[model samples]
Target: MMLPTRLQGSLNNELNDGETILWLDQPIASRMARGAWPIVLFGIFWSTFCAGWMFFTINMAMKTPADQAGLFAWLFPAFGLPFCIIGLGMLTSPIWVRRLALRTVYVLTDQRAMIISRSFGKTHVRNYTPEKLNDINRSLNDDGSGDLIFEKVISSHTHTHRNTHSLGHGGHRAGGGRSSRTRTSTTTYGFKCIKQAKQVHELIDGMVLASKPVAEQD
Candidate 1:
């Protein structure tokens, strides 16, 4: 199939001598924008809280004499800094997603599916043949754009722990720790936020069927 001129050069570089492009498209920006709400809310909450804490810690550090501040006083602002940065990232994740949609491209050929993404000044290309795909499924959006999932997507979650210990001079110290744990995963790989999803699914199904042996088809 004919590809957009902008994508032709990149895809041509990846194609083998005889590989043919069956489909090529980019993900819909609105769909990504819709998917970004949860992240935006989380970012807002995280950034707001972390920024407040960071300001408070710095204020406390300034109020106390350097000699009397102790190691914990200095550590407080240091610890808060990373959290503040992380929160800022979370807050801006939606904009990043939109930018990513602009830089990402998807393609399906008779031999395989390909995803080309550029982020942080780096380009990543992922390829999947029919054999490499499993449990292909579709999720449709209200706008008729949808995602096709081919592989499982696992989400990582972090658990935090707070410990309070009594120090020698009628004083108590508080410390926090965090660990990551994974839960059940959902499907991840495949075309994301494309139009006419049902047609695309059927086309892919036909391709997969045609690739199987004649005996398997029966």
Candidate 2:
């Protein structure tokens, strides 16, 4: 599908010489509705509870005399502030995600796949070359819109540290402590919530095959 004029203009300026656009599209709005009900419910519960706590704390603080209020009265409102803000943010996250989709564009080119996103007054672009891609997967929604995960990169790190503590026994001291921590993170890249994801996936696969050298094709 042809992109809108404004979107096309922005993409055109970013294209490399002789690179051709094969497919381009934005995410569907209903994408937000998929697997979002649980989050929405949690947000509602969290925000309602936090707001009530905030109001109650503020009212109690106001009713307490300044001299008697002390640190406890002041601390209550301070404690409630972060939770209130976080809850409100959670409640509004779905709306934010949907709005973000409006400014996001996905492009498939002969040489690479590109994602253009404009958020918080910043424009960011991500490009993935076919040769560098790994573990391509797809998840389709009932309505034929889905996500194409072209790469899954898993990174792991482990750290070990020793601590010494003094143990006094008959004028002798001994100490030893060892701790280890491991962290794993997985990052997936590709078109998210695009229509005709299977078709797009197949098209990209064909492009990748065609881009291979003649000797590699055999």
Give the local distance difference test score of model 2: 0.81
> What lDDT score belongs to each candidate, Candidate 1 first?
0.78, 0.81
Deviation from native of the Cα of residue 62 in model 2, angstroms: 3.8
Off by over 4 Å in 1: 1-8, 65-76, 155-187
RMSD of each: 5.4, 4.4
Candidate 2, TM-score vs. the true structure?
Answer: 0.77
User: Which candidate comes out best when scored by TM-score?
Assistant: 2
**TM-scores for every candidate against the unseen true structure:** 0.76, 0.77
Model 1 per-residue lDDT tens digits across residues 134-174:
45878887767788887766776656554545455556544
Give lDDT tens digits, candidate 2, residues 65-153.
99999888878778877887887777777787887777779988999889887777666888888885545788987877789987778
